[model samples]
Target: MSGGFKDAKKDGSDPAGTSMSNGHMGIREISAGVAGGKWSAYEITEMYIDKIKSMDDRIGAFLTICEESARAQAKAVDEKIRSGKQPGKLAGVPVAVKDNICTDGIRTTCASRMLENFVPPYNAAVIEKLINEDAVIVGKTNMDEFAMGSSTENSAFRITKNPRDVTRVPGGSSGGSAAAVAAGMVPVSLGSDTGGSIRQPDAFCGIVGLKPTYGLVSRYGLIAFGSSLDQIGPMSKTVEDCALMLEAIQGRDDRDSTSYRGEYQQDYAGRLSGDIKGLKIAVLKEYFTDGLENEIASSLNESIRRLEGLETSVDEVSLPAAGDGLSAYYIISSAEASSNLARYDSIRYGYRPKEYADVDELMEKSRSEAFGTEVKRRIMLGTYALSSGYYDAYYKRAQKYRKLLRSQLAGVFEKYDLILGPTSPVLPFKIGERSGDPLQMYLADIYTIIVNLAGLPAISVPCGFSRDGLPIGLQLIGPHYGEQVLLQAAYALEQDLKLGL
Candidate 1:
């Protein structure tokens, strides 16, 4: 923890004494701070530094805080602001990137020891956008190693505790970003959702999470897990804030092979301005499978009624292979993980153990000591799936099922504008609740993986709360290239629900 980190439970709020402006101000406040000379970018940066240093000991959201680089950038933004030039839409805004996204000059650990000391010489595509937009990179957040787990407990350094309840888990891979935004450490952050990393935690913390269409955002610098599934997105306290970040970072990045062609119109806020009269919405009945908790089921039902009240016709649709989402996700992702991670040898660019004299010994020692158990397990499983004898049984079969899942989603999209469902089958569990049980933890992601598998877009908006006070999230899944529809529907539903920004 840094010296400037402030404890939320102890200091409560605004260590920098920055005042709150009705939640609507969100990203707008960064401009207000600069315009009024109320706080320099340096001061705002220091304030978050103080907050993170204080709260991280408990929340453990960040894997590493780029203090020097952040301070330096903030100082420059302050100079630009003082010079009477627009620092950009996100002037002085502090954003946290999930660890899997590469950041130049900083260790991109991915919350795994395997790349503990690995510092890339170049920034990821998203990093370039944030910097170009004058957003200060606060730090890299903790995540499930290679995004292999649901709860952040799989992280090598520490698990991200939910900001709402410290005893519970923050949803994984993007947990650190989700928790950071929810706890108000930073107004907005970016998280990757291969399954529900962004959405689930957004639900857990009562925030907005958007999983854009697979190619809507470039994946050039994001470490690959499931190449077909992973998509990076914004997590924020409000829809506008989410839109602000998304508009800045999204669009065509030619560097990424999968990047969308031409300009994909960078106006999400405009899309949100759509009137929601007579829009068709579908609630996937398959989402309410046997394992969902009673409370989440009820909360989702209420959210559907709220949509119906807004003049949107809501009906039930079934995605037959939705139940197989988790199964297919694990197999495909793990196989890809096995292949993607093969480059982390001690030979170059990653943690190398000093105790070994021979090549084989060095590689073995480095990986064995640096990599966590869950990562190793996936590596093994992935390797097995891709192995000669079992390739067809595991890897190929999983791909076929993935095709089935995507086709099923396509069929649903033919009738409805969006599919509504639970982001997670239940609310976040205890911190150590699913630690020892891999299968159970994997099940927590069952509801989310299908979206990733289908390469569609989804958002998790706070719908209601459980009897125990935990928040329930309703996921809005849309067809490929459905970012506009997803945002419009989410914005309208959010307005109707009126559950705080």
Candidate 2:
């Protein structure tokens, strides 16, 4: 907490109305700096390098920091800008990408030793967007290897520490992205949320994280784990930054067959009117039930009550089937993961261990030695689910539940503009607290995994804090492709709490 908000220094003279958050400079400030010739892409890159060099050792948030590639890209952007060319919207912005994303020529390990030296020859679509947008790729932040765990401790590279309290876990599989932004090493980070990865960590770190509607953002070249649930989205210090970054990356891409065809909600920034008069909001009773700590629930309500002033109405709603989302989500995700990861066989990519006399020996040893515990656990679960006889019981039933889950969400959407709840049942725990029992760790994702199953858009904003100093977040779930409603509601609370506006 050495520097947060920094008193929102958006004084009268500042046209950008930008706050001095060491966390990030929004697209506005970066664009303004580029326009006024105050900051070049090269300078922004240097700032991030300086921040990373000074802060990374304490945080352990990054799996790999591609310093040279970033600096070279920044230099090229500066050359373009100096030549009187419009360098695109991001101009001179610094963006940190999740390691799960593929970047040409960089080892895009998902923090698994299996892909420890796997350098992709192609960039993920989202990475291409950032580069084309003139945004500098600061580096690849760490994650739960293959995006499987709730806490980043599953990362084989290193556990990402919460920037707010180093003792606590930063939620994952996007923990490094959240920690980097929370630590003020970069302005924004891109994370792939197969479940709560982005939003949960943003909550843990008191930053803003947006999981754009599935299909709203392209998944081309994203290293797959739960392909149906995975989504690439923005993580930043403010909702505005989230929206700006989302705007730049969202669009239809032929590479992804499920990609949205003009389904993105527009005028997102314009819709942040700080007025939610008459918007119907639902508070899920189950979310505030047993496991959620009292302080976390109270903070959720604090944000809910503030929304009441905007003429919004809140009501309790029952989502009985939601309890199954966690179970079904695991089944389906792991099932898909089993199929997705089959590509990592020694023949094509990743670590190919010593030469075993037989194929089975080689496969078993390479996997056993390369994959982490959580990764192995999921892979086994997934393999079993997708295995011959049990596929109907586990995999097929999960799909049935997935359909039911979608129906349930649509039913809720019929009655409410947004469904509100705690992003996680409790604030983050110490890094090693729940590692002994994997199931206990999985339970923390109870509130979030459902949204991914339903493929609806959601955002987790810092509504308040616990007396113990842990941050609490209120998650706003909107109908499919309903970023406008989600962001508008979040913006109102932001303006009201004055948390980080």
Candidate 3:
């Protein structure tokens, strides 16, 4: 992998088509460059905006470009810095937000026609935090409608192609966010995970994504999908940038009861000692199953050896129930989605039908006309699961299974510092390859969904690449509230594997 990057650099072509320097620059470098007068805030912002305008046509990563607002915010940061005042940690660094996350006055279409014109009244808690830190919100990236699908193909707007291979998918529902960062459109972006939405996309895009422990970041103003499962997290070009993004957004919020309220850890990037010596890391034997790709398996073995070289003791562990994650997650998340998505009845704020016989007819017509095929399918599945007699057989049973899976993971954490696995079961598939097969698309997230199910912190870091040149990801999952350890392990791995980008 290191040799591949070096060879690519020699040709001035990176894996994602950006120059080597652009692909490798993370939040720290960009922020420092802006703050030290290397470039003005507005200048940096214009660079990304121009890059997006020029490059995103091929990638389809961004849904809405906030050029005016971004320039205004960048000017403000520049003014603050020129006045001899601190402009915050993220001063002038351009960042993107997943379209599902509410951005006041900006249209946050979750890649669904239902809310294509919807403008959120307030910023998501994370968005507000990013603004306070002086991070420029360049635009909103595309995503699966309501964050339901594993592949960005489910998006109603446009499919976000993989920057690594334009024909292949960038993974979803955070595919657009990952693609933006991977293509060097921005240094960092915010994404939501409800069953591997963030981590899987990061894996496919060959970048770093962190799914904070459930409640580690606020969900307020983040349009709900699976309420219990959805969480806001950071997607960045490097582990250090991911840590900085997490540090900026993670904290308590009065509006969100689920937000972590107790004394919390800060300066996450600052705390990375990069010493994983003697760290007890367990490899899930179930992850390397029949469905797993041979290249990914080989890559995992090589990455484990690298960790072993760093003095980390790796052992194989079996979680017999781990294979059941996909089924259980679909059921549980669908049940919650049915309840959460009920608000778009056309009577309130979403798209309303031009003609309808009654209120109920209006709601039905609007939803039927606006919702995409995938969103409608989930709504039906969820509605059926919550129906009269099927509740106990499906949704309730899935909850029980979820609890058992969480317990299985909790028990593993007691004996190990982290559990490691391949983030996705297979390599990135070509766009439209799995569009006709929902089951196959769901299985792409087989290894990552369990982490979200257990409400644990996990990160997907670039480990290696496939024979076809796509990036492979190494997933490191930690115990609840164990983000510090997760970032430390990931940083150590990223430092060791000098993939350049």
Candidate 4:
């Protein structure tokens, strides 16, 4: 299929009664078909369930499949339509949620053993919003343990393979969410990005992923990794689907203190006019430095040329503070993680050891036995950084650097409508390629971490492919709360590129 579900008939006609199962259909087509009575929501849900059952064993994208609940949701949607009632925006579309986003009664594991069996009593704000829109939650996708690693190999359960290349990683810790959309298991999925968790994985899997401005979406029930840096976003097969999902989930919530209280555009998808003429886009010169792969660099250059052809002005700019983003992000995020994860002692609701000498040993052994290596490593690093003498030297310095980076990015936005760059410096690598080296794995997110550090909006869209057929992605970053223009520009480029999965 071409970009934006071009093959699907717009007259709401069902071709051969199997278009719902076609894997290439976009969100609007499926929802509209179900609402218009051209197709039943049950049929759409069943087709997606069947696809997941047949493909998930090989892909390892989902940790749990809520077949029973999904069917119940689909039937409810069909009943609502039959009663002559108007359905919500995402009427009958099936959505896969990252395991970290709590769904009431559906075990939210966060792909970590510590909370492997922990069932949340409440739904995350995003989950409640999605369900309110009538979206069906198909299952919870896997991720790195507590979202600590670059490759999904760090998951205590199983590694998520890239749908484009099984031998390669799908990127993490949102790899499973990206793979689910890439493999067509679902039209869209939710993933949390602390430092490139969402965009890096989307780039690897050849899909669209958006990290909304911090506080655009509520974080009430998300398992905190880096409380300040983490933001929940949508991963989808196309940019239109991404925008639709974002519109469904974004709003002000009284429960989350950090939730954005400012008013903004509501219909993100409806605002896609594809008219980005005279848009000034700045290219970060530091992003094109040494470690970038040749194919990705070439793909980014071509994408820039495409934007130029669209009458948008493209110019190279430098942000020296961006070069130090990785260091600051790790320190700040890890320190937050260390504090957030401290509540998981044996005395709490999570995993607990049967044997312990005392309360001290219970907490110690519980963490030691349940936490993965990467989680432990980060906790230690964060604990050290937050320690007495070293606090100023490390964590404090990182915070100062973060402020400088945000200031520099804000300056760029004053002159440019958006910033463009490669989503990842390297292509999707083999599963075990960099897992053994922590520093190397951290470097994989060099191009993406700065967006999170600044708490700005950014998206990764498929640009082209490598010679070996691996998908390459280009990133488009917008000013805080500028998702409208950001998405319009991305949708225009996506229509121009016409790259199909």
Query: lDDT (CA) for every model shown?
Result: 0.81, 0.84, 0.88, 0.89
Q: Between which residue pairs do clashes occur in model 4?
A: none
lDDT of 2 by residue, 336-416 (tens): 898898777776788888778888887877888898988888889999998899999998998999898899889999989
lDDT of 1 at 501: 36
TM-scores for every predicted model: 0.93, 0.94, 0.96, 0.96
lDDT for each residue of candidate 4 in 1-501, tens digit (9 for 90 to 100): 332232322322322222223437788988988889867888778777877877888889999999999999999989998999999889889999999999999999989889989999999999999988889999999999998877788999998999889999999999999999888778899999999999999999999999999999999999999988999999998889999999999999999899998996788898787688999999999899888999999999999999999999999999999877888888998899999999988675888888999999999999999999999989999999999999999999999998999999999999999999999999999989999999999999898899988999999999999999999989999999999888999999998988856
Question: In lDDT terms, how accurate is model 4?
Answer: 0.89
lDDT string, candidate 3, 358-390, tens digits: 988999999999999988888899999999999
The most accurate candidate by lDDT is 4
Candidate that beats the other on lDDT, 1 or 2, i.e. the better one: 2
The residue-by-residue lDDT of candidate 1 on 386-452, one tens digit each, is: 9999999988988899888778788888988888888888788898888898888888888888888
Residue 110 alpha-carbon offset, candidate 3, angstroms: 0.8
By TM-score, is 1 or 2 better? 2
Runs of candidate 4 with Cα error greater than 4 angstroms are 1-23
Error of 3 at 301 (Å): 0.4
Q: How displaced is residue 203 in candidate 2, in Å?
A: 1.2
Q: Name every residue pair that clashes in candidate 1.
A: 4-50, 5-50, 5-53, 5-54, 6-50, 6-51, 6-54
Evaluate model 3: give its lDDT.
0.88
Instruction: In model 2, state the lDDT of residue 304.
Output: 80
